[model samples]
Target: MNFQQRKNKILAQLASRGEVDTRELAMALDTSEITIRRDLNRLSDEGQLYRTHGGAIPVDQPPLPFEFTQKATANQSAKDNICRQAAALINDGDIIFMDCGSTVFRLCQFIKNRKIKVITNSMPVIQALQNTAVSLNIIGGEYDAARQAIHGSMAIEHIARYQAHKAFIGADGLSAKGLFAHSEKEADMALALAHHSHITYLLCDAAKINKPSYLHFAPLETVQTIITDAALGQLSYCKKKGVKVITV
Candidate 1:
């Protein structure tokens, strides 16, 4: 097929599957991987799609802050898989910081039976574990009604006052520049938690691997490990910066 024909096919795949990987697209089109990469790059530059670690996702408007209830059900399966892996990393009597992201909230289900202390700003997470044996500490801050979470200078100060064995946070997108969030306050809260914890874990689904967001919260080195449902080519870049990845 001609160059334009190849590019069109890539776009069609992204539209149908929401994402297109370089290797997979090359094999499907009977083209070299290098040619596929070039097509993806061109498409990205033209704003036709958003380039990811090993693939590209359909192009759309910039992301906005999503409501907790809305996001909790958006990618339930991937979030569940990621949460299961995160819960296995927890042990009895451990203290952890859980962010307000939906993926982090899913961890509550697996960890409810464990004897662990959780420090969080997420109202949903608090509600999820309210009947469990786990100890909970809610951060004090100005509440964000849209996000159903707490954030502000008060929340950041509260996070810094305590240290945890681990901190599990979520991101809207992950690129070579680092983790991205939709809101500055949310990013601030995540950064504070990562700083005060012994180990920071970024819990994200495959859809978030190469997405873009307005706020660049922290570099990949800010977190000690990344927990996800798919392999990310960018993991190599993160490894060189001393960040480990756990793909479930």
Candidate 2:
């Protein structure tokens, strides 16, 4: 089949199954895996889909709120560094709450070797840690295709049933007004994560510091710690308010 036909088939599979694996697509299209990869790369570059470890998922419709894959690439180095520090805080057998933020998602790779229980609402997180040593408990709720996460009142209710030693979450922005997000649903999830955990850690990059989004979910004092890049280490206001600021 031609590139156009293959692309259509790939997208059709993603729409039907919510994801498309390279090998499966190759087999279905009677093409080489290399060729399928090239097509998936082109489609990813064109924003037609978001590439995962070995597959592609549909991009968010309208694309106003960034897709999970898109956000994952933004300030990637900073996110990885911050996540490294966040991972250090985790101990063996500890139960943690992980939110569906791009930065928090990076934590999956770092903590895979550790023996810990992760309670999360992110499908991507579940996929990343499925084969790892870390135990996972997925928060059941409505799946949001755009965010590649779970949400809704049911998700919040599910989170309330468990308590964690630490909560790792993200925000669209942080300011004197507190943690904010572009979507109210995300803000609510962050709040629920913080509420059910003994200690909450806000994971964000420098760009989000002091920036405020439309919806404010939690106050600055809600989280006990904030992990970010070195550029945003001088958060005197946060320190004065008893919030530990750790920069990497």
Best by TM-score: 2
What tens digits encode model 2's per-residue C-alpha lDDT throughout 1-248? 89999989998876655556677788899999999999999999998998775567667522223466668767777887899899899999899999888889878767877899999998878876776688999999999988888999999999999999999999999986688899988889999999999999999899898888888888899999999894644476886788888988
- Cα error of candidate 1 at position 215, Å: 1.0
How accurate locally, in lDDT, is each candidate?
0.83, 0.84
* Candidate 1 wrong stretches, greater than 4 Å: 1-66, 232-234
Instruction: List model 1 lDDT by residue over 133-218, tens digit each.
Output: 89999999899878879999999999889999999999999977899999998899899999999999999898888777998878
For model 1, what is the alpha-carbon lDDT of residue 33?
91
Flag clash pairs in model 1.
none
lDDT of 2: 0.84
Give candidate 1's error at residue 248 in angstroms. Answer: 1.0
Best by lDDT: 2
